[model samples]
Target: MKKPIKDQKMVIFILLSNVFTAFLGIGLIVPVMPSFKDVMELSGSTMGYLVAVYAVSQLIISPFAGRWVDRFGRKKMIILGLLVFSLSELIFGLGTHVSILYLSRILGGISAAFIMPAVTAYVADITTKEDRPKAMGYVSAAISTGFIIGPGIGGFIADYGIRMPFFFAAIISFLAAISSSLILKESLSHEEREQLSSNTTNFFKDLKKSIQPIYLIAFIMVFVLAFGLSAYETVFSLFSDEKFGFTPKDIASIVTISSIVAVIIQILLFGKLIDKLGEKRMIQLCLIIASVLAFVSTVITGFIAVLIVTCFIFLAFDLLRPALTTFLSKTAGNQQGFVAGMNSTYTSLGNFFGPALGGILFDFNIHYPYLFAGIVLIIGLGLTILWKEKSNEVSL
Candidate 1:
């Protein structure tokens, strides 16, 4: 029989590793997309479509994955998701056709559907309510670190060849899968798993019952944040190339710098920021700041101006992300995987609309995506205002 596992830190480490691995693979592509488009002879809309398809696939899979993570156990789902993530990156490296890119996105989306909830649920399982925020801080830090660092690293690797980063990302993901399989223990007990199976026999029923107003608002906020950011991503490289005549490496540098700012906020300032602003008020402030920055992006003309705005954007985004997630988790209580999955589902919807809309708008005018995101954020801020008196979550 297996010895009873002891340290919670090990569980937290494994979850952090899984998140870092997933995001690193995703981020590696951000800096290299311009090169890929030139090689593939693709347009802005097609690029946006690629991003949208991934979200669409994830949107379809997330709710099911959320329930399944609760049912099948977190460790198994995370390993499977990581393996698929590796396969998606491998496909991206191997493909000469655009169809392969689409296929890879589909796989990536499916992997996200599984991994997001499983890892989130795993974090909840390993920590007490008092410790959950700090645990989540580590989780957010790992994700943001991978996201910001991955772009610069990918750009550097691309000096060898653009496809090289994809191949390398594949290796990184595969290794994460191996390490997790060897070292990570399942969060759910056998009895809990059995009882979960019997109790959650009706997936739709359980999903319906797990609903709450805070969950709904959390979903909407996730959607809004993703929608606004995806617009910037969909068009940033294109915008830089068109307006400022920036190179791929230059765009990578900007992304890397912005991400560094974000990672710093995620790690160093999360609690202090929340404590100082309060979660409810902070959420409102982030939305307003993001909307303003996103709008400011449309009118800015130079590389340095854009870079400064981008850093602030990342900072606001980082603060907003963990704050909203912590708020949602505090409300989620026991059904961590399912609630987290729903969060992913709403995020996927935003992802879908963001890229698709951004791409469509890009074909018309380059600045439209940024303007569009600003509008979305404004709407989100209005909703946040309405949410003020209702969500009385004073402290976290």
Candidate 2:
């Protein structure tokens, strides 16, 4: 007998809670990172490498993590990831040396590689095809809220002590994990489990087959997005301090506002817009907007201009992500874990390269990072045009 449809609202709540913990752990550290570097007497290149290390770890582990999620189930992976994340955050809280900090980031990256894709795959399992985009939007909104609030709270507390943010993040992760363990139900059936377990294909073959053209395009787009964002992150604080005469507090405020705008757009408008405009067009439009705003940000000097341009950039990113996620999940069909894994891999690649390149460019000039990011975004946009044409041709 077919099971009755589960309550969507409850599932979304659980998913959002999961997202909150994930982003809170990551976002809360952003403002304090520069301060941490200053106190530790680290160079810009070291800081960039610190950021890149997370993604590098994720890239290395994602393929195996994906297969494990497919074989073991999303619920298990989520719980395991949370546990790892919580422990890593605790270590980060107690860390005294740069090497320890690097270890913490590596651990967090592994946990993130597992948690993020697993959570999204679980959401895909629960929602119907018609409702998937809306579901993804809500998840994205939850992520955005964390991005907004986490940084603000972290910045406020980091003024008191750097370790405080890490402690709070650990607490949040633990609580979230406990909530998920109690409330989130298993969505996959015995038959699905059997299929996954019985599959005998070689891992490489499964991977190649699982990655369709649309999936590749989506991965590329996400890669570009991550690359650009990471580059900005690598240099934004230095740029503000050196060029704009802004304090760390000011940079934190700017990021907070940007994330707030992102949350509003993702929660209030993204679903309706996706329903009306379709995912492909909305993604393209967002890419164009992000590219323009990125360029504009290069020329702007004041806090207000930074805030305004960042708001637009965040809005575009908010719109772009859910749509891409929806596209990836839909294309994955039954292989949700594999697709999610691929997404994680591409993002990791972006994270690895973005900061490294940004640091290299920053050696020459702070503005070079943003300017290069703007150029890369334009290139991504151009690729989107090719993607569209290819998609149309395939449809015909």
Candidate 3:
């Protein structure tokens, strides 16, 4: 029996809601974190470590989470992750000590490792190969939309207190959790489940098999892209603060504008581009464009120029994410959760390394982080070209 396309659409809608909720919770922290630094008397290195610890936990846990999702079920894992995320947000909102905040971030990372990859695998399960990129684009758009609203609201609340943003984030996440619990259905068919249950392959063996060269290349591309982007986030607000003497409110407005640009590109341009040009080509194009924009951002003097370049960076970054993920999903065969988990693991690696790199660069100079990111992006572009050529040869 054929699954109805309408049912698939409903699943995508629920997944999008999930993505939006999760990111809104994270985005609310971005603008507020710098303020926390001031209030808590935390150093730049301390801030970097605090953020990187989350990624470290995610990197360690993602492979296991992915296997569990494949073994258990996507709907179950997503619900569990959402519950964990909401609880973490609640803790984060209520905590006064930096140690508590650190614990919250670590817990949140564990939740994210489960939620993000499972969501991607679920999309792959429901979507046809032809329409996967379009589905992924919607996911990306949902994230950007959350980012657009989250920071704006967070910045407003930050004027009252840094903790207030976390409260709002927790509420949003809890609501999303309820929605998912009600609406999301299992994508795995009974026959497929039975086969998996009967065969009883070891999870680690399956994980190892999923880490093929193509998958590894895809993971590297994602890692590099994420690293560059995360480094930018670690330093961008500080740069604005130091270079332009911008307040938290002004930084929030700038990020809000970037988020709006990202949302537009993800929704309006990415799907068409991915369908027409193919995912590999789109990835290459985005990398080149982002690299150029990152370099330009460093050289530009005025706040307005920086803002314009930043818009381009956001556009490229946002478009690349879905394109890359779609490509990986298509290539991963039956190991969708494993592949997605590997992707998450790479992203976690980026998140961990990028901030530390950015902190070092920031200590030397404000522009160094962007400069380093551009260099890394250029390297990624080279790898992307090689990967594309190799992929074509394999397909032929």
Candidate 4:
């Protein structure tokens, strides 16, 4: 009895640690990727493809990953994901060729597909309705903390060598895998697994099911939100490098500062404000904020102007992510794994298109990616308004 109680306390901590490590690994690459592109003589479109391939891999695997989380239990998937993430990072660090980099990204995407649904479902399992907002706040904090630290470390470490950050990311992720294997316990029982397995469906079935009127609007919002953010973010380092002649360290400083501010706000305001305003309203507010900031990003000329616009953009994204997750979790009921998986799928789809398009836009004109991102957000906001108005009429 005491052991079960103890495991519950430790589980969230271990899960948060893994989340941090995963994001940290992702953030580390951002500061150095432009340098890698230059060294490889890669085109903007090629770089965008590199990012898109990861999302494509994840998109293909997400349905299966969702089912596996329910059938296989979350702990097993999390451990497997960490191991794969470590391997992918190691490969990326060692490989000199573009082909090797693509292979590494594919593996990384597969690992993300495994990890995200499992982790989210596990958290949903452990928390009650009232505690969920706070729980998600903690999750976002972990991610933001990783963003704060990863690039900071990567930027300074790149002085030693560009590949050093990848090697370091690999090492930390491997250690995290080992730690999780030892410390993390399964959140779902055998009986629970059997129950969930009985309700499982294939990828297309899940996709089709998600389009039912109950879920369609929310899922569309998720896709648009992800698309706009990814388009802007994927090109950001490249944009800074090209337009402003910024170094890796400069990019790292801007990101680190913004992440720190966002995390602080997330800690103080995210859960309480969500409780007060509700997810739908918060989502609307963030969409407006993000859309405006993205446009501002294109016009900004100096480091300070860029930093201010970037900070607000990051803040909007930070708040919007957990709000969307919380909204889905509230609606999911017994299908947490399924909903989480679909969420990842939609996000991957957005990520896939956003970066690919952003890269093409960047090649043609560096300002076009931000312009594209703003336009997508405005479209999303319009849809959100219409959806809500329709929903209210039905309720009436």
Candidate 5:
């Protein structure tokens, strides 16, 4: 029993590490973006398009990725995703043209579409219902920690060369893929995969069927929250650099510090807070907090003030994510892969529109993204009134 429990722990660690490396690759590019923009002679809208394209690819792939996770099995998809992530980073590091960077982003989105739902469903497979919130917290923390470290390291590494961090990210991701391929165990059985495949429909059909009375509102909230958050984040470094004359290192430091604080809070208090507040209540509160703070961000001036606000803003976004995941997972019985996939789908949709629109707005006014994000969150809060959780009766 002890050995089995220890093995489960090890598997969880490897799974979490995969998530960390994937996100780390994402963060690695952030601090270098301003430099990348200048070197490529790109405009603000082009920068936004670069970010939005990743989500666009993700939105397109998530439905198929979800069904594949259910049909194929988690371990295979996860390994494939890690490999794709490595390749995307390598391509981005090597690319000289803007078109190549866009291509890399498209591949990156495919990797995310594969990894996120698969890992999420993998975690659900391994953990018991009572233990899931804590496990989910660890999963969320790994993501935050990766984002925290990626920019900090990217900032310092940019001193070597702007492209160096992407190469580093590529190497680490490749190593992670190899490690997972050798050691990670498959969580789902053959019988389980067949069961899921028999029940699962194609992407469009599944999406159409998902709009029943039960979890529809929860899905909408996911989209709304993701849209608002992406709008704020997709333009963050650009926002800092343009508004306050912040350099890559300065932007990196602010993001790293803010994310560290959010990760610390997640590690220390996430499960306890969820138990006390419930997922729905916690999400609502975070939405309120984030919406207000997004507005405050536009008016604030000093670096210190911005850092303080950024920490709280990150804290809210970080908390809201797992809270919503927890809410959705509670009722999603055998359809963990399906549910996680839809979660990714809606998130990708919001991610797609948020940056696409936010980039245009950012060009018009540096503060417009934040203002727009705040408005989106306010609308999400209003929609939360419709979110009443129930047993998963409708199959996708």
Candidate 6:
């Protein structure tokens, strides 16, 4: 057998690098989506369709994704996922037809199904329970960094051509794949792999047993949070173009600033804060604050005020993500890959519906989606309030 990892930081750094590249690909297209609609002569609903299709594919594959991560090794799966992601971006860049775009999105979704569960489970495997939150924070910070930086670059390069960002995405993802193959060690032990190979049928039964009430609530919360957040993200460019009279670069700038704030909160604030406040309270607080601010954002049209509110919203978002991830990991027990995959499934459900509805609502009234999202977040706040967790319970 290959030797166990001697340097944990090196392994983690490699994982974070791959995460940054993966999310960068996703964020690269966000700024240029409006341009696609104009050039393709597509309606808002069609735009939403394109966004939702990716998540829909994720939804279909996520149940199996977890098993695959455990069954195959994390290193192999991560590298394969990156390869597929780069190919998908290449397809998106080269294709001119709408159907080809759909195909690209499907491929991207499949790539995500492989990437996220494996990455999260890999984190869980390497870190101690006490250290998990901070490690996850580092991971989240990497993703947020990619998101912020991608748009800043994408918006500018997109001036050359809308497809330029896709080519950039392809190049970056390919590099990420090469890095993973060369540098990252597999997280799963050989004993675990042998056990998995012996119990194909029992894996399903174990998965069924792993779904507990707290986990169910955690799943629901992840879905609702992603749903509400997606409404804002999916239509932000269109809404700003119409209401704020902002160009793509302007929209990109605002998002870049918001994203930078998020990165700080995730890396510097999220772990220590979650350790002190506890996951349940953090979720409730972020939901209510984010909800109120999202509503206030609709009424305050001034760019500076909106940006101020956006900072708070981004902070809320950053805080909630790690909190929920820590909470879900606690509930997952030994089935980290399955639980992470389930988490991705719920998130995919939200992503699928959020954009479709947000787009339709945006066409009816630009302000409606934001208002409705705030209302939906309130429902999540209520759910968190009702949840019960035992004192002194540790995930292990």
TM-score of 1: 0.89
Q: What is the C-alpha RMSD of each candidate to the true structure, in Å?
A: 3.5, 3.4, 3.4, 3.2, 2.7, 3.2
- Per-residue alpha-carbon lDDT of model 4 for 1-396, expressed as tens digits? 112223466777888888787656545666776899899898888888777788899888877888888899998999999899899889988999999999988888888788877877778778776665566657756855764467667877787889988788788888888988898778789999989889777778778878866667788888987788667767898999988999988988888888788878976898798988888888889999999988888778999998988888888888888887777766776665567667777888987898889988989998999998998888887877655422321110
- Summarize candidate 1's per-residue lDDT along 90-167 as a digit string, tens digits: 998999999998999899889877887788778777677667667766776686676556667787788889899888
Superposition TM-score, candidate 4 onto the true structure = 0.89
Q: Kindly list the per-residue Cα lDDT of model 3 for residues 25-137, writing each as its tens digit.
A: 54566667677777787666666666677788877887677667777888888888888888888898888788988888888778777787678778877877667656765
> Quick one: RMSD of model 1?
3.5
Across residues 170-262, which tens digit of lDDT does each residue of candidate 5 receive?
888889888888987778789989998887767776587557766687888889877876677778888888789888888878888988888
Which number leads on TM-score?
5
Candidate 5 — which residues are off by over 4 angstroms? 1-5, 70-73, 124-133, 144-149, 186-196, 389-396
Query: lDDT score, residue 70, model 5?
Result: 85
**Candidate 2 C-alpha lDDT tens digits along 228-271:** 87777667766676678766578778888787777766768877
- The TM-score of candidate 5 is 0.90
Model 1 misplaced regions, further than 4 Å: 1-8, 147-149, 201-214, 333-338, 389-396
- Model 4 misplaced stretches (Cα beyond 4 Å): 1-7, 125-133, 140-153, 189-195, 275-277, 333-335, 389-396
Best-matching candidate per lDDT:
5
Is candidate 3 or 6 superior in lDDT?
A: 6
Q: For model 3, what is the C-alpha lDDT against the true structure?
A: 0.74
Per residue, candidate 6 scores C-alpha lDDT tens digits across 73-172 of: 7888888889998999999999888999989888888887788767876887787766776677677667657644666677777878889888888888
User: What residue pairs are clashing in model 4?
Assistant: none
Worst 10 residues of 6 by lDDT: 1-10
Residue 158 displacement in candidate 2 (angstroms): 1.6
List runs of model 6 lying over 4 Å from the truth.
1-6, 124-133, 144-150, 186-192, 200-211, 391-396
